[model samples]
Target chain A: MHEHQEPTPETFSTPVLSTTTATATAVAAEAAVPGAMLATPANESTTAQSLSTASQEPRQGEPTAQSNEIQLTDEQILTQMQAIKDEEANAHPLVDNSVDLTELEKEYENGSQAFKNKIKNLSDTHDRMRRSRGDGNCFYRAIAFAWFERVMLAKTKPELYTHAIKAMEESKDLLLAAEFEPLAFEDFYAVTLETLESVPTSTPEALLTAFQTDEISNSIVMHFRLVASAYLKTHQEDYAPFLEFGQTMDEYCSMHVEAMGRESEEMMLIALTKAMHIGIEVAYLSGNQSADEVNFLPFSPDTEPYMPPLVLLYRPGHYDILYRKSHCLEGVV
Target chain B: MAKPMFARRLSKELKDLAMNPPAGVDIIDANDFKVWKLGLAGAPGTLYEGEKFQLEFNFGPNYPLESPQVLFVGDNVPIHPHIYSNGHICLDVLYNHWSPVQTVASICLSLQSMLSSCTSKERPPDNANYIKTARANPKHTAWAFHDDTV
Candidate 1:
């Protein structure tokens, strides 16, 4: 018999869509059946279901494409339910103590239209809860990509699938920077599958090209893959799942390491050339030096003509090849 | 030149702070470049009245672009449910809502205001068990910040 009142000013800005849906689903599910899925589902299950439902519903006032590409994987959906069940059993504390949820469930079932109103009233309160938990536009994007991944995988649309992958590649920085890591994986998986769909069936070149341009993140990734590939070649028996999630980062790291190894002698010559060229104080060199630091000197066009010693060093065979190639790939550096 | 870029910007920010420090706040560590510590006074007419709290601010190489890891220091930790015993705040702005514009002063002020307006001196009901055991990992534990009846 608590009277309805507007939420306080402090909590007006919390992200509510996921909270409302999650709460409504929980209450609705409870109203429909009590003690359901009680065999100890994991915490990830609730987040997955919340994420899946988010994918289905369009944002208010904005019409989302009926993207069949996005659907929650069976594993993801199950994870959501299990997580909710765990939360209910283990973390029994709720912010509102006025009406007990267990009591409210019975009250809601027994012709309490007021209960529905209560649900609606508390919607705003939960919205802030969601926002505070790091749900935002990025979260929505993850859900959307998750949906896209499921639907496209289900139907096999190469174009939309590839587009989705590219979308993920573009949005990776956004996904990575988020505090919520679980959703990031789902989004990343969707994009990877989508990007895989876009690759032409016959050519690894097409795959390499896609990785080079639109999927430059994949370049860093490819470096990791190259490293892993090399590792596998050397230590095939001891393969680890750590780098199995995706090849992009592993590949990128491996390639950079390989490149530095190959260019070390040239790098030293370049550092010597730069010291002679610019005459810029080569102040003590106190810290741990990296290959990229020395690599910068000989290849830098601005510093090249200034040093006659550098020009002489650069006039050689490998140095000439390295300089020409470096200049060509100037933007990348 | 790269050193000057950071040095100049930091100096400018320091000068700006000297001219107009946030209300009842003090910026310390003008000499050391690594550690930036600021002091906060609890806001009046609230639970945290007349208390002085200090916050430690650490800046990484990516200044402004990356948010500072701010933590409440010393004994007067605000007894909020969301705050960790180790003084790590669970506020979204300190991590996710963190904009580049928010200075050490502004963050200290926000925390001060958040403390001053508190009607309850208790932690969230789940805080005792959750905070006790949840120290294992902050990232994995999903804190339900949804208390409406407060």
Candidate 2:
């Protein structure tokens, strides 16, 4: 992460740098531990954003002695910016280790009474929460991690693992049937399939590490997104009604479902869960005082063999993995 | 060392273009993946009939993921409402709306269609003013695609 960071003076007032890092750091510290947010390598991202703006700042007059080195082409700037985005994404672990559920409570300490009451009620059943990064891909990341972890812990029942591998293998056919080029999508499918295949021998830490890798984690999220997109495309009659007045199903899926960093809607949740036969229950947390207990939306596949649903906690725009006390596993760190 | 993703996608594109090229589009020079110049002949019935335009595509390391730098090159730049005299095209897919699924062939087809559908033969509204300040690379321009119909 340091290798990617530019050699900008930290003590100086760099507005572009400060503004971008603030949302990811200080404010996020209250919800998820301060240490985790502070650890994100964010310097390069700021410079990449404010390249044109940075040149306008007449701080201490004239240019610094290293002016010659700053000349870069638009292509160079865009590439560097892309690299910084990748590095920033890498800084935040995709799926963090489980933290006590009290972290959620701390976020709303100074807030509304409705939020307080809901948190108190949530404490009854859920023990811990694993945060996924809030990079708009949170919904996909959280669900993928939760399901992969569930597969890792199912040592006693090997068939669940077998079924998972089979489902992943067949997802390729889904992509092909949906007219996705094999050359374009095969690589993404391979990264996810190979990782899932190694799950029985893999540890929880190994799964987390794999998810942390920029290429591996994003590939899994992307492949799953394609799976969901393909499912939605093939079953247009079922989901097309949810689209806006004149928008077609393909337009909606291309803009929202298939694109990375596009926030997920309920339709995406249903399509992804139903396509993979992986049931999931999402607990919706809102500040509506009318509801005493947290609202849970369970997506169940219409089949006999779907595994017990993995849990996810949803606040306004983000998602994080939720663990119930009932989930029993032999070894977890 | 493994071949980079751009290399693989480009080779496949090169093969596809050779086997079945899009109508009125032919590659002039594709010696390497970094830059490829292709000829785009005006459609038979379009306003630009009998005119031949060259399209230059600059592929960065992030080819399919990031859009290629596409523009009309050579002396005969197209005179279309969306195309600037400087060869920078104001199209959504080439910029903000880029997706990985769109291949080189797809972009050529899009350019062909953009030319085919043209109802007028003229420069964009702010052509002279824009070309004076526009950077050599079209991607740097913060294009406001106010109109799609040309």
Candidate 3:
């Protein structure tokens, strides 16, 4: 048994992050097919940054590698990729440095009974899951559900609800098996928004517009407009200019900003919460989407023209097959 | 003070757990914010039965963003091929598939369910040699765990 489980002081927490482990883990990664470089911090950082900027800019000059057809078998690339990720992990801090749970604890302590009680429960649940070694379990699912309920419940503010709903719907479409191309976005947006307007309150009708997009249902283009309008309203402080415009629904959805008032790590949490809401709505809407459509990308700010409408395509058998193949590559499960 | 949004989200998880504790879970260590020990009752319809298991969790500075590393502890550590003698569990959601959306109770319940669902009681095929090698060169020797059945 090793006496010291922690890394040495020289390496500290940040430096000893396994650069090589990223490669090793990339090899170990389930969805990550071969030909993709091991997930180094540098690689992820650059990729994540590009993804952020790309979200802003239109899909104009960037080379859409028509060679997306290049295929590297999972097995052949696993070893080299894992080695690379492992190396990357060894060198860079894989996690953000700005989290201070202690402060959160203090805040909870000083807050309202409902607030403190609510927070303490979450903390306690988190603690229990950790101790139980229940990493991949229902504890995660339950938490996800709770987060979803809370956000939806807090939908008293219309704009927040609208933004949250639209974002959630888009995520649902992406994670579900059936594909809705960018061409479908405008139609989806228009009809969905008109239906949302018809709903006097936050009702199931609003939910219906998200997944069921037929004639008796609503036009997809109208759907996008209503949802985008709600989003613009909810985030008025950040998106005031866009709200003023009679801009196209695509133009409205295209505007991206650095998630305000939070560190990058926290931003991930917000994104995750948002993703859960998307999943919940999908489930309620009887849409085929899964929770994976939540944008799990890291944060980086940039100035660029907005990209064309992008859609998430959900693949049902992908995750399990990917998990199995990933284990095979690492020669470990 | 305006509560940080993440904290509010975390709070929501706690409320749900208290209202609905999964079938066989007990929080052993409640005071320490970072260290948690959970007790899982043997799940029904699986290999783990009438046996109690312990799991330990260590949260990082970035609590929600970074998932806690979990280790199975105590004598009941399953002798399955996938599980090592030491309680370190190798599951993806704990690391890579981890999203801040998941809460502690959900994770434990999932583990409990997985434990109950186990059909085989054997360690991974290479367990013996890996254990032997790990005894001396713990850091360098990585266990090549390979088994889908268990």
List, for all models, the DockQ compared with the true complex. 0.01, 0.17, 0.01
- The ten-residue window of minimal lDDT in model 2 chain A covers A1-10
Question: Candidate 3: which stretches are off by over 4 Å?
Answer: A1-333, B1-11, B128-149
Q: Which stretches of candidate 1 lie over 4 Å from their true place?
A: A1-333, B4-9, B130-150
Q: Rank the candidates by TM-score, best first.
A: 2, 3, 1
Model 2, A127-208: lDDT tens digits are 7999887665778889888888888888877888888887887788888888987767776787798889889999988999
- Model 1 Cα lDDT, one tens digit per residue, A65-130: 233434444345436545543443233211111222233234345333545454334332221111
Who is ahead in lDDT, 2 or 3?
A: 2
* Tens digits of per-residue lDDT for model 3, A25-104: 32232332112111212223322222121011111122322233333343333344445435543432211122222333
Per-prediction TM-score, chain A only?
A: 0.19, 0.75, 0.21
Model 3: which docking level applies? Answer: incorrect
Q: In model 3 chain A, where is the ten-residue run with the lowest total lDDT?
A: A313-322
Kindly report the docking quality category of candidate 1: incorrect
- A289 Cα displacement, candidate 1 (Å): 51
Full ranking by lDDT: 2, 1, 3
Error of 1 at A70 (Å): 34
